[model samples]
Each structure stands twice: as structure tokens, then as C-alpha cells.
Target: MHTRTRVVAFQPPVCRIVWAPRFAVKSASNKNSRRASQHEVKAATLTNLSSDRTERRSFVDCASEDTLHHPSQLPDDRQILQGCESVRAPLNVAVLLSGGVDSSFALHLLNRAGHNVQAFYLQIWFQEDFRNYWDSCPWEEDLSYCQQVCKDADVELHVVPLTDEYWDRVVAHSIAEIKAGRTPNPDILCNSRVKFGAFYEYLASHQDHNFDRIASGHYARIIRGDDPDEPVRLALAPDAVKDQTYFLAHLTQPQLSRVMFPLGSLNKAEVRALAKAAGLPNQARRDSQGICFLGKVKFSEFVEQHLGVWPGCIIEEETEEVLGYHQGFWFHTVGQRRGVPLNGGPWYVTQKDVHTNTVYVSRNYYSVDKERNLFTCESVNWITRPPDSASQVLCKVRHGPVLYKCDVSFTNGDQSAVAVRLECNDQGLASGQYAVFYQDEICLGSGVIQTTGVSHAEIGSFVDDQTKAVL
Candidate 1:
């Protein structure tokens, strides 16, 4: 049977899932109009999840349709205590600045320490309307945000427009990986390809080859080598709850040497505290979420804007019974249970067939289960080759949790479907996400997820058809 699922995406204000009230959505929509009304609504600020709608009704209510925003649980003070030993500051860094708190805060810390860090912001493909808002970031808003600090610290500020060619390199490749069912982490790719990519080339020539290193505000640590005898490779940041190393699993040694993470030692609270104390203006501003460059546009909004949406079916995993209709499949990720209307304890998305537009749901019973355990991946970019095909490894799927024991291997097991076999299976495994591999918390490498939960027979079937195309 064909696996691609179809979904029905509703228009904003009348969405099937009421993230906010209808009037609220309408008020937000009212602002998107071209005519400058006497009453301009507050700009909506949804990110990868949702944006804020001003002049629009309030979407962030206790009624609870907002699953995109991460829950609030600050890390403890201990988690932020990693700067104990005086560390070597980099000579220079090509930091990715979104003009938001994270990047902005990071630039301050690095520059204050006398490290050479040039900032760059990549503009993801956006509509003319939204694009104008973000333009103010570098030229008007974030430029001021960073300039004040950069001026105080006497550091130079640089901005690079994300050229059409740049998107082809970073964004397009990432979308392809996701469409093929691999969980592509654009943040990691943005750092590696954008900052460390052509941007690095531009900086070298611009600086007359004077700078020495690249730095940013990623909250991750390094473990450095394969064995204990080897040096520490970049591991999880000291702030476990906020450590973004899961996104950085793709960084190889060469990149690591040139990279610097000043916030590796600080937790979210600590960082905020420092921001406040440092007198950085955006410090108290709400933490910006979503795509780094896109500002507050929702992922669903952005994707629908591009690919557009269509009606689709929601089905039960076992019975394949039609449960309800949806606006679009792209709006959701696997393990999601909030929007789908099934009256029970809860149901997690077990599978999504893009072609059929079907979302398969399983009751939210097990934290981890066999159905969730079986996942496949491709676009495998390992920092170095794994020690063995099935070495015990610590793997994390997306930003859900810490590293768990898993057997690491690459197989034509699914053709175009590079595979990862987790030793202990978990429920709610979503396809089209990254499976970051590590050894004892140190990032080993990562791959894009292709398939999740295929039986031995299916694996064999894939091997037999390896020579053929996946679709």
C-alpha cells in the first residue's frame, strides 16, 4: 500500500484546532492586509510553532491549543556552572545572529572577552510582506540591538543577505531531506554550511585573513575523541535542559576547532540573568522562537504559504478507521496529539503517509514502544565513521530527550532509507526528524530519518529493491 498520507489544513481564524479564539485569529489576520489601516494590529510572532497576533485576539490562552511553544521549565543553577576553568578564547568567529536574544547575547559575551567574532544573519525565503519585517532586523532593529553592544565592546558588526544561491545550499537541501522522511536540522546546517560555508570565505577575504576562529551562542559541550585517551570531543553543554548539542551533532573536528560556544556553560536562567545584568536591551524581551531568520511566522503558515494545503484524513493506526479531517499534514510532526480530534486519553501520530494524507494515531499509552522503535534514515553524515556497524551508542531523536543506548549502523536496509536501530525502542517515533548519534553523551554523528517501524521482512524487501528508486 502507498504510505504517503494526506491532510486537510484549515485557514487561520477558522482552524479546526482552536489555538486561539476565532476573533483573535481574525484580528491577527486583519493585520496581514496590504492597506495600512488606522489601527495596525500587533505583529503576530509565531515561530516554528506559532506566532503572536496583535490587534488580533489573544492566541495564547489557558484553553491550550498552543503545542508549538516549548513548555517552561528552567534549568537549575548548577547546570549553568561550566565556566569554572579559564578557557581559551577563539581568535575570531563567524557567528549566526538572528538579532534575537540567543545570538545577540552570545555576541556580547564573546566580544567582551576580546574574541574576534563577526556576526551574520541568513534570511530564509519569505514573502514580500513578512520579508520587510525581517529586513528591519539587520538594518533597523537587530542592528541597533547588536550595534549598541558591539559599539560598547568596540567589536565590528557585519550582515550578509541570504542570497538566492545561499537558500539553495542550506534551505533547499534541508527540505529535500525532510521530504524524503529524514529529520533535517536546519540550525545545524545553517551553522555548518552558512556561517562556516561561504560566509567564512567572505570573512577571510574581508578581514585580510586576520581572524583566527568562529564563535556563536550554542549551548553544547565537546567530548573531542573516540576513547578516553583521546581529547574531549564536543559533548552536551553543561546546561542539559538547554543544551543545543543535539543540533550540532554534524560538526566534524575541523569545524569544532574553528567554532566557539560561549553559552555552553550557562543555563537559560543564567543567560537571561547575565543579559539583564549586562544591560543588553533585548535581554528582557521574550525569547524569540522558530526559524532563526524568519522571525515569528509559524512553520505551518510558512509551509502552507509555499506548498499550500489540502484536505486529508485522520485514521486510527490499527483499524485504519477515519477519525476526522485535517487541513494539512505538514502542520504536524509525529508523536503529536494535540490537534487531532479523537475522544480518549490521547492519541499520538504513529504514522503519516504524505500521498494519502493520512495521519495514523495510536493511543498515548507507552512512553516508548516497538511501533515507535522502528525508524530509518538517510543523508547520513557522520563526524567520523562509526567504530562498528552495531556499536552501543547514545542516540537522541530530535530535542525530546537525552542520549539512549542504541545499535549504530548504516544499511541499504531501506534504500534511500539510511537506518538507525535504537537498542531500547520508544513510542511516538516520528519520521522526518534527525536521529543524532553519540557515544556516552559525546556526539558521534547524525542521520536523516527515512522510515520508522519496519519489520524484518520489510527490511529484506528494501534490500532486494535497493537498486530501484524509493518512490
Candidate 2:
């Protein structure tokens, strides 16, 4: 790790200044120098220059005072100020603390780095009417844990209520997608619409504090582009298994520029170790699973509470055979094997007929007519620059640890919609689920799956033949 010392000092109610070591710099005569000098003082200042009562802070990096000795050798405050005259100040960073081990550890790391860190917990779950069904919602417990962690770190904690926004943007959209027979990842939408979107705006609009950037516990990285005009790109975390770039693929360039992920480089084990070392209260707490706002309640139960239940027929795709009956097709997804009440061994869901309220199943999960190597996607969002249409890209259709090599091409001259053909067959490419694109470890962009070349007729004949042969 490069050793750069940071010195922060607040000047009454006006502003606070931070001085740090600069990068390598070129000669004064070089007009197009790219390197910054180590002797140069890089200062970030939080100035209260706005006429309104609110304090506004901007991150400005300019040339400042002469370079001093190493931070470890600094003797007095006077010398520190003298060495950092023309530099910018430290940033006032607000971290979205979820009361989980990841966010808590991220907050600890930021504080240790000597940044002005404040913790904000978004209150996104409210079950006033459906309390009976959602009694297991963990917002209260999570909030308590967040408060404890913030108190231990001696940082101010803000509880920002965003329940309405979360429901309107993330939960509502998720329910609608599932009802339409499409599998939607609510966590992805939550990160884009709630965590980075609404939460960030709330902090920025606050009258008291002017936060420079917002940080989260997501396991992803932001690599700054070399060109000033180029947007920062989102990259995979060092821990491949825990990388969350897929969930954050829909975020725009501006949303990403103001966000930071402190846990990008550390894996789960390392995060646990760091949390233990920092004496966080919830170091041993188990990781949360399923939809975040749903908490411990079953997803089906939650959906039923909102969408209600509709009886549907579970038919065998091969023979049009009614294998079983389901309470609702909306609660099920393609490629799902569990919770399917079928008498003949294990069955996998292959297709859904929303209009007829029917679900098609197959005994062999991989052998289905709906299985295809090609699909189409719409609503594409590129993180930085769009990749060449002819270039081969690695694509992930779901949140699992698999990445498939695929060929991508825009459809009907539409830049935002794409057709992707994989090297091998993949079943259950659910509509509304994002197909994230990548080149090696760098996430290029993603698009919502629109359609796939899955023919139910082809699958029906195969299943019928197999059954006749077995009989």
C-alpha cells in the first residue's frame, strides 16, 4: 500500500481543510503532463460559501504548499499547516450503514483512514397493515445494531425514512414483474433506486451537512477513467464469489461517481476478521438472506399478502399433462425446482402462461424446449463507454457465480436492446432479470432480458416421446 498521510483541521464555521501527499508530477514546462508530484500538497476543502444557511462542500484538488516530512515525523500542528498551504481539504463522506457486518466494517475502515465519516441508515421497511404476515421484519433490530456500531465508532448516525420510496420504486416494480411472469432481482433495484439513488439525494439535500460522497458495503470497485471526459467504470470485487457488480449494473455514471464501496478488495473472511478486530457488536451475526425489506418472512407469503393467490394448473410441457395444481403461478419462476408439488420425483419449472394462469414443468431440468443459447434484452445501461457491437463479451444471466461467453449484437438498430447468443444452452433466462455484460473483470453494462428463443412445442414433443419409450 502507498503511504500517504492525511491532516484535517476545521476552521470554525467556515470550512475544514485536509492535506495529503500528491501523486507524481511532471516538470513545470511540460504542458501535457499527466503525473502529479509527491511534494505537492493535495487539499480538499469543505467550504460554507453558500448564501443559504445550509453548508455546501465541494471537492477541489489544486496546487498548494510545499511538501513536508512523512506524516509519522510531523512534530506540531503549525508545521503541518505550513507544509499544506495550497492543498484541498478532507472529504465529508456519508456511509450507508445497513447494520450488517459489511457496512459496519466499511464505516470502520473509512474512519480509520481519517475521513470525516457519518453513518446513515435508510428505514425502508414499514408493515403497519401487514404486520401479522411480516412480523419477522428486522428493521428495528437492524436499526439498533446500526446505532450501537455508530456509537462505538463515535460517529453521528442519521435514520432517513425511505419506506415509501423503496415500495414505490423497488418493491412495486418487483411485484409487477413477477406477476407478469418475469423474475426480477429486487436487490439490484434497491441498490440503484434506494441505496445510491434516493438515499444519496437525501444526504446531499440536507441543510446541516454537505456530504462530498456516499459509501456502501457493496463488494464492487470504481476505476477512474484516464480521460477527464470519460466516466468511471464499475469493476468486479477481488472476491469473485461475492462480487455485486451485477446488482449495480443499472446505475448511471453520475450515480456511480458519487459512490464508494469500501469492501471491494476484502473477502468475507477478511471482513469478518476486521469487524472482530474493530470490536463491532454484530461481528458474529449471520448474513441476511432473500429480499432485504422482506426480512425473515417467506417471499411467497409476502407476495401473497400484496398480490393475493390465484389457482393455476401445473402442466407437463411434453404431454400437456396436468401434473399438479398450484395456488398461484405468480409465486413461481422458470428453472425453479423446489416448492413444486409434483408426485413424480423432482420437477423443474420451464414456462409460465400468465394469461391462462398455467405453469409448465419438466422432469429433467436441463432438457427442455425452453432451453436456448440465444436471447434478447432491452433497457440496456452501460456503466462507462459502450463496448464494440462485434466484440465477444462475457455475460451473466443471473446472480450466481457463473459467467457464460456470448456474442452480442444490437437489435433493429436499437442501441439499448441487444441479442445475445451463448456458446451453450442455458434454461430459465427469465424476463426482467438483468443480463450483465463484462469483459474480463470489468463490468461493461447490462440489459433487461426481453425475449428468448424457447419454443414450448419443441419441448412438448421431446417429453412425450420420452414418456412413451419409458412406458
- lDDT scores of the candidates, listed in order: 0.54, 0.67
What TM-score should be assigned to candidate 2? 0.75
Runs in model 2 deviating more than 4 A are 1-89, 133-135, 226-229, 368-370, 389-391, 412-414, 454-471
Model 2 lDDT tens row, 1-471: 222223332221111122211211111122232222222323333322113222323232222111211122212222112111112235678889888999888887777666788999998887736755355777778989999999899999998999999999998898889888888888889988999888877866877878766888887777665664677778776444466888999998989887777676544555676577678999988777666566667788888988898998999988998888998998888777888988876788888899999999988665433346667778998887666544446788865334666666665343676667765555657787889988645788889997776343432332323222110
Cα lDDT tens digits, model 1, 188-280, are: 777667666666667656755455556666777543334534533666653333567777766666666566666775545557766776777
Off by over 4 Å in 1: 1-90, 93-95, 101-105, 111-139, 163-166, 173-183, 204-209, 223-232, 292-296, 341-345, 364-370, 385-392, 412-419, 456-471
Candidate 1 — what's its lDDT?
0.54
lDDT, model 2: 0.67
Q: Which ten residues in a row have the lowest lDDT in candidate 2?
A: 19-28
Q: Backbone clash tally for model 2?
A: 16
TM-scores of all candidate predictions against the true structure? 0.68, 0.75
